[model samples]
Target: MKNLKESLKRRFSESNGGNEVRSPLRVLLRKEVAEHIRSWRFIILLTLIVLTFIASMYSSLSNIKSAFVATDNSSTSFFYLKLLTLTDDSIPAFHIFLSFLAPILGISLGFDAVNSENNNGSLIRLMAQPLYRDNLILAKFLAPLLIVAILFFSLTFLIVGYAMCISGIPIEWQEVVRILAFNGMTVLYVGFWLSIAVLLSIRFRQPATSALTAIGIWLFFTVFFQVVINIAIKAFIPDPNYLSADKIAYYNEVILNILRISPSQLYVDASTTLLMPMVRSLGPVSMEQMAGAIPSSISLRNSLMLVWPQLSGLIAFTLLLFAVSYALFMRREIRS
Candidate 1:
């Protein structure tokens, strides 16, 4: 700890003496990123994610051969995307695995962001330096977010590269665009959880409490929330067995809307739409609306339009949590 403080002080002194000046936020951000990278928890989390990626990729590769054999040339349109969205029963698709694991990663990175420093008495000492409270908060948030972006993007490109090597097929421009969009959505999804973890870190003094709270919220949304929704629908909504077609469609829409309240659902919806171009709608579509619609895959523009609401919801939720965390941290009293 003494060595780290000395290094940071030296860097600041050197920067001040040189022609180049470093912003306090940048210096703090670098410190945060370096600390996270070096932490044992981060190492464990990264190993877990990499192992899952290997399993998912193996499943995807094994299925890809059969998938190619079964599909005609026209149906093989998004072959590269299949590498990401395809999987056997034993393991979920890469994107699906990401949907489940990424939140945990984000939460692990951020659940102790503020409280741990405060508990260790570093928060007060750090604040005593020539740093604004906002810069510290922003560095705490942005550092993890930046690390997440790099990790996700690196894994995504690795998948792309591996798929190309095995399949010997050049990826389409549209597929590239779609994959990039999926990566961006994933980063945002993880950022949403990161924000929640940060919020809890600020709210709770004990890091353990905040960590468990974040995990509990994750479990509810990932597993039990859907169960709760199903029970509510069964209790309130009329049984679909005797409902008219229009009523059934409306009922399904209601269920979907309620489910979309969970960030996991939103991410699944947006990612499915982006990766699978055949998906035309997120909600139930009546026969009348589908009567003239062709079964062909939609264009990238149209797919984005289809999932724009889900994407917007993710962005809005993430920003809202960060804003609340910012407000709380600014008003917080840090005593030496």
Candidate 2:
């Protein structure tokens, strides 16, 4: 008890005028972020990211070079070009790479964010400090988001560098800014998923269970949900062969709205629109393509705005999950 009192007094003295100077939340956030960076997991994640990017660049370099060679002419100089013209195929490759890999990176970095601390008993020690119980959860959440931002930027730089080197062209300011904007959106999208992982970590005391839960949820949303949603839509809409054109249009709009509920699908739809010039679908597209595919339903800005609802939904879901964990932690009794 004496030690506890002295510790409290010292903590108070270090605080600002009886109020905590550095919130426990901030400390926890910083500590978690630093720990993540220093850990082998983070290093492995970075290594994988670099490796994947290198592989992608290598695989696509031949095609990109061929395209450049085909287009190379005395009249059209690679220099003095204001923008790197993105072919439809180029855009799809980015989407494919991000979709398959970004979530893995996010989940790996964050699925253990809180559960590990709890398992190691550091969480109890952390709460003993002059910090609110919920601060640790909040910090865990913030740490993954920061890491997401950093990884996204690093990827953006690498992609741009590769593009410049392969094209043997100077990247324009506008192109750089556009790439940054796309990457910024991607970071937020990926961070939203990481928040879900954080929420799972907080909910499960066992790190392995928490990670498995996160992965399960990801698979359901990305893979199973997609199938279920498509089937439901198809069953209800049923080709609309007997419907009027206006009715068909209305049905299509409704289906689209419903589909956008899944962020991954929203990401696919939006990215396709945003980078239509650079994107290409790998699987067999419907007859709609051969017949001159309908242009994207929304422009890039509009598509972005449209995705805000889904984004908000994801963020709110994460926050709600974290809040529940925070409340539980606050009520928990730490045994000496």
Candidate of highest TM-score: 1
Per candidate, the number of residue pairs that clash is: 0, 4
Q: On residues 1-336, what C-alpha lDDT tens digit does candidate 1 reach at each position?
A: 454466566766777554224466777888899999999988998898699768977887888886576444565468877667777778888888999888988999999999999999999888877667888889999999999899888888887898789878788899999999999999999999999999999999999999999999999999999999999889998777889998988888988999999999999999999999889888888778988887788899999999999999999999999999999999999897
| Residue pairs in collision within model 2 | 88-278, 88-279, 91-278, 92-279
Poorest 10 consecutive residues of model 2 by lDDT?
Answer: 76-85
RMSD of 1: 2.4
All candidates: TM-score: 0.93, 0.74
User: Which residues of candidate 1, in runs, are more than 4 Å off?
Assistant: 1-22
Candidate 1 has its poorest 10 consecutive residues by lDDT at 16-25
Tens digits of per-residue lDDT for model 2, 96-161:
678767778778877887678778777666666666666666677678778878877776577667
lDDT scores of the candidates, listed in order:
0.88, 0.63
